[model samples]
Target: MPQIPPPQQQVTHVNPQTLEELPAPVMQQIQPITPGQVRSARSAMEDMSAAAKTSPLTPIPRISSQTVSLSAGASIPQVRVFPNQATTVTFSDATGHPWVLGAPPYNSSPCATGGELCVGYIPGSAVFTIQPTNAYASGNITVLLKGLATPVIINVKGAEPSVKSKTVDVDYRLDLRIPKRSPDTPVYTATPEKKISLYDKQLQSVLDGIPPEDAQRLKLKNAPGSTKVWQIGDELYVRSNMQLQDEFEKTLSAIDGTHVYVLPATPVLTFSVNGQARDVEVELN
Candidate 1:
């Protein structure tokens, strides 16, 4: 014998003052949904929910333009360093050339260090490159720039073991500045901006080995094979094959199977392979 169904519950909005259910409002329009549409939405959501724990675990660096300015009389700030990655410090004159020389090309002191932080640069140029030789390297370095009133001190340290966002501990690029350029410094013409295709400006930048200034690097914990990801504004730039089922706005086809696709930005990105959803794996490029 068939079982009887339970009574259904009716939900209605009520007015606080009257404590009575308000009259049901008439529907303006009836939006239609086919059975297939409902199933597709539910399947998509389930795929994402299946691997929440395997999503990106590290905060990826977005391609950024603003430099961390080092000013005089400011407290020494620690710069994150990583083994095998070089952190570069550069001081360019108003002309954009290394400002290590004076009106007559003279400098007072070279880079001085006393730690496992290996520091090196051109003898007279105002660019210093540093690499941490030890995994737990912790030390400081002082530099006396030419014509500067005071020396610059940099505190270096190892990656913290307890930080979730520690993937960004990879080497950082540094830009140094002086209070003012000397009076006798001559003005030089600024270099023209490198021309990039208007259609593929952002993707082209990555291929050129320099991402656009405003692009942010997103760290992907499980990027698809050989795929890289970046975020520019609301768009997610992907360097991978075009075997994608989801809709994408733009793409750059490459002779190699790997290509760049502009996809919708989401907290987590998943790639569909053989009807199965897989999370993308990535690292700092």
Candidate 2:
């Protein structure tokens, strides 16, 4: 009875299986990686930083030549200022040559190669900047031309230190011009001629022309024979051609001090006192 019940429920239904099989999934293509890209970028950044550190330095320079020409009157010529460091400096000049600015050693401080020249500039202050390139004493400096012979005055404002520090500002400039030669030039000088003019009548007449005030101004002394004493001044004493400003000075070793005062203004003598040699305050009797 159990087997008959199972055979009665054996009905099977099969549907159409018409679905297409899907293609195998393909893997995504990956890009090839280049080597050292990160390292190159790091190296580039390092170079940029290094460039930023070294480019703005300026050092002081020495003056190679200096000249003053009287032909140009008071006008200053173009003077070149060089820096002692390896940095670049900007300067200016618009006038003639006499105003050409040059820098010298600052005070007691010596100017060394690859170092600062001095300090302080009034005209162009904002153009100054310090950098590592100025660590040395030689560098290219630019002087900008603003106006002419307006007296480009530059001074060293900072003190030079024995030890290097970033605090000091080194600057120096020159005010120069050709010195004019005076019109009254000494043309002829008397040479050492062994001729004595003491007894000459013409020389005595010439000597008589000298005022008593002039003779007193010279502190001329009268003495017997050739030996004479000329009391010149408290500090200065002259014997013959020798002049002495100090009592202990050995320059007048040949002159013996007799302290004799002379009358009349005579240029003839073996030795004579020159200049305002006496401080006599005499009252009239």
Best by TM-score: 1
Candidate 1: what lDDT? 0.54
**What lDDT score belongs to each candidate, Candidate 1 first?**
0.54, 0.30
Candidate 2 Cα deviation (angstroms), residue 125: 14
| Residue 233 displacement in candidate 2 (angstroms) | 36
lDDT of 2 by residue, 155-237 (tens): 22222332454333333332222222112313331211122222233222222232222122333445232332222223222
What ranges in model 2 sit over 4 Å off? 1-36, 48-60, 70-76, 81-285
Per the 3 Å backbone cut-off, how many clashing residue pairs does candidate 1 have?
14
Clashes of each: 14, 48
Residue 254 lDDT (model 1): 29
